[model samples]
Target: MNHKLLPLKVFLLLALLSLSQMFCGINIQTENPTADPGFMATGIAATLTARAVSITPTVTTEQATQTATQQPTETESQQPVQTEPVIPEAASISVSLDTNCREGPSGDYQKLGYLLPGQTAALIGRNSTSTWWYIENPKKPGQYCWVWGEYATLHGDISAVPLTTPPPPPIPIAG
Candidate 1:
């Protein structure tokens, strides 16, 4: 073979080999001059890693147990939550303008004192008719009065007791 044609023949053989390798599923990834190959590969790897992290819930039982234990300790160290005392509200008291408070339990009971619209009273009993509440006017000392339930709303102080019974009162001294 001629020397000039020998080089041409070798070049043709190499090209054919490259073409056959491509047809046989040989992947030869060549980096483009415009972009860094490493940067592109790293970005693709990072994206795949992020996708894997999202797809899988990586928490183990030990991790969950550790979190559970740590949380209650933090919660216990937190301040005790203050809650309003729950009261079984039964009755309420209100005032009528220029209202009269009686001296005794029944009407024809003398008016011992009077109350104004802003006065406060404590409900003590129910009236005979059940339509009115028997109230002790807190403002008028030692006075029991009556007011209609239709006009009065309920008022009572609610106190929180610890969830246990108190100890019994001490026995009376012997005579």
Candidate 2:
């Protein structure tokens, strides 16, 4: 007789006794068929509740994955680079402050005109000094004058051509 056989035999007997005790506590006095029906209904409801809880998270994850796969590809590819547009050739620019349009190139010059806010002018030329601009006054049409470059915005849509008529043909200096 092996000693291991003795322990195995004891374990088997203890398992059978525990199972019998469980059965004794479970529905053994079922002379009442009404009691059996209630026990069966409770077992069925508990099984359904356990199954529903186990399946809910799996169902939600699968639905989310399907939606992600179905999204349009074009939306991912169409992102544009954001940038400001370049100023057009005849684009308008603003004056920095209130100032006078002068009659000549220097500061002691006579004031030929004045410009108010939103006054649009034709940009003719930038002086060699670069501080003055020759502009055409639209209010007093056909009048051309020198404006401090600091005082006016070049109007968009006005040509860059010389504001005044082209100069007369060069005089034929005697040889």
Choose the strongest candidate by TM-score.
2
Task: Report the C-alpha lDDT of model 1 over 21-137, residue by residue, as the tens digit.
Answer: 756864445444455566667667667776776686656765443221111111112244455554444444555335666544344555656655545565666644455556666
TM-score of 2: 0.34
- lDDT per residue as tens, model 2, 10-55: 6556645885776565542323223355556666766777677566
The most accurate candidate by lDDT is 2
Alpha-carbon lDDT, every model:
0.52, 0.53
For candidate 1, give the lDDT of residue 165: 24
Quality of model 1 by C-alpha lDDT: 0.52
